[model samples]
Target chain A: MTKKKQPEPAETGATEHQLWEVFTQPGGGKPFEHAGSVHAPDAEMALQNARDVYARRGEAVNLWVVPSSAIVASTPEDIGPFFDPGNDKPYRHPQFYKVPRGIKV
Target chain B: MLGHRLSEWCGHGPILEEDIALTNIALDLVGEANLLLGRAATAENAGRDADALAFLRDVREYRNALIVELPKGDFGFTVARQFLFSVYALHQWEALSTSADDDLAGIAAKALKETRYHVRHSAEWLVRLGDGTDESHGRVQDALDELWRFTGELFLTDDVEQALVKQKLAVDSSSLFDAWKRDVTDVISRATLRMPGDVYMQRGGRSGMHTEHLGVMLAEMQVLPRTYPGAKW
Candidate 1:
């Protein structure tokens, strides 16, 4: 089995700082959405950096930082087959049904 | 006053990310100054508006901390000074948030949130710079030592602050010294930095007797207003 990459030491002098993807909740019951990224030594620093970088404008009430390396991403080559099928499946959408009006049901 | 100081770092920060960060911090300070100065204008009730009070004030009439007005030094010095000031400002804002004057309290409440972020940013930089490399450590240490003298001025309470405290409009500045020291020492220890020994503290910013730096800064800051009276944007 292949070995997983390890995080660098969280010391200030550490040479390798990790990149963290920032997610922010805009409040009012909205879900967290991807904001941007910040470079920090650890989770604590990453959260603080995210606040300084992404929430400077009061645009977010909550923030989450995830290691960029931990994200499993699919490339553009997979887009055609991986996500295109949803375009042809319009029947799954609620708008696809035509309700017979006049009755409450 | 703080906005101008922070603006000095606008294009001069060591890196792009930090440049933006410093500018943002400057903007936050400027906003806070606007709120506080607005209150000052209304309280004076001498027919001066915020703009007139801000732009027309003589050098000796200004009341910002001497530390904030000091020239922006090297990156290490800048961050060190910022960290030190933010520590004190955080406590000041915290106390001000509970003031009897609703307007002051409201402004302080908003400023407190921003100041919290400023403290975190500067404190982190202090640790990184203080422990990063030998050269960085030495430079940041020098910054801490040099800026320490100006710190006492932050907690000095003169007649104005005392009056405000009695009126429930302001916190006694001296009361913040212990908490400020605890916070500063904690960060210094974490950064592996040494606290400078107590020295003769600088004074006079509160009483309007400022260093020469304020004179040069005011010349540039007031140039526009003096050059063109009642000019609108």
Candidate 2:
């Protein structure tokens, strides 16, 4: 199978600093969505950078900026084994439980 | 004046999405103004709540940045104002998020997100209009020229900002000017729009001074409350 393309890292020989991941909640009741990334001098500047980059259309109510360096991401190769055990736990499946008629999932 | 003008679109935007978007930004700005004005009221011992400070106050009592009061000439102008202000606000909120005042910092932390989208939406439109048809380009450029005069007021610092800066409750507004310019210019240039050249800058939004438009806006916005006198929706 063809491998999924990965996001490229920051280019080398660039004078500007690193990128920051910006997550946002559209409103108080919404979950945060990864809006996009921005580059800036530091965490404080990163938040500003992300604000300048992401939240333009009433699409966010909250913002969280984490340095690209601070994040610990799992690679695709690690996903199968790391998540495999839980897949075989049939008891964890909702299908085993009986539901009342007309009940929605 | 701009906030009120934009707020006029509260229930009247062309589409629901645009409606929500415009109102949301208006509320964000009005909310921010409320906070600042409330603080100013307290400092001045004006004995007014935020609503009173916002609705009951006359034009001469408002201290909003002039850029926030200018008429929203058209969608392009509105977007231009939103674009510039959002960039400025994003930087302001980011800095304020770490302010010494916990309340102010917390508010900033929350507001930064809203302001972020305001910037993005405006920027997106700026790109579309700037790089779209010749008519679109021309009007957007016209909007920029008309709006540029008010921008200087955004970065102008006075006693309040100075005192707040000393108290660590505010950012030095001037410090963000370069970033604001770079951010706005980059977007304008990419959109193929010309930035207005050396122009006479309008001042006086921060000293309870205002444009004639504010009186009319306040009249309409405050009429319901003034007429009903405590009637609830």
Candidate with the greatest lDDT versus the true structure: 1
How displaced is residue A25 in candidate 1, in Å?
Answer: 2.2
- Model 1 segments beyond 4 Å from truth? A1-18, A80-105
For this target, which candidate reaches the highest TM-score against the unseen true structure? 1
lDDT by candidate, in order shown = 0.86, 0.78
Candidate 1's residue-wise lDDT over B126-195, tens digit each?
9887777677788899999999999999988888778888999899989999999999999998888899
Question: B1-233, model 2: which lDDT tens digit per residue?
Answer: 44567787877764444565677678777777777667666766857776777677778877778787776777788888889888988998998999998878877888897788778777877876787666667778888888899889988888868998998888999999999999999999888888789999898878877888777777888898788876678
Instruction: Name model 2 segments beyond 4 Å from true.
Output: A1-105, B1-3, B35-46
Clashes of each: 0, 10
Worst 10 residues of 1 chain B by lDDT: B11-20
DockQ each = 0.17, 0.03
Model 1 chain A weakest lDDT span, ten residues long = A1-10
Candidate 1 lDDT tens digits, A1-105: 112234345645565567899999999689999998888767877887787689877899999999999999999999999999989999988879888888576
Tell me candidate 1's interface RMSD.
9.6
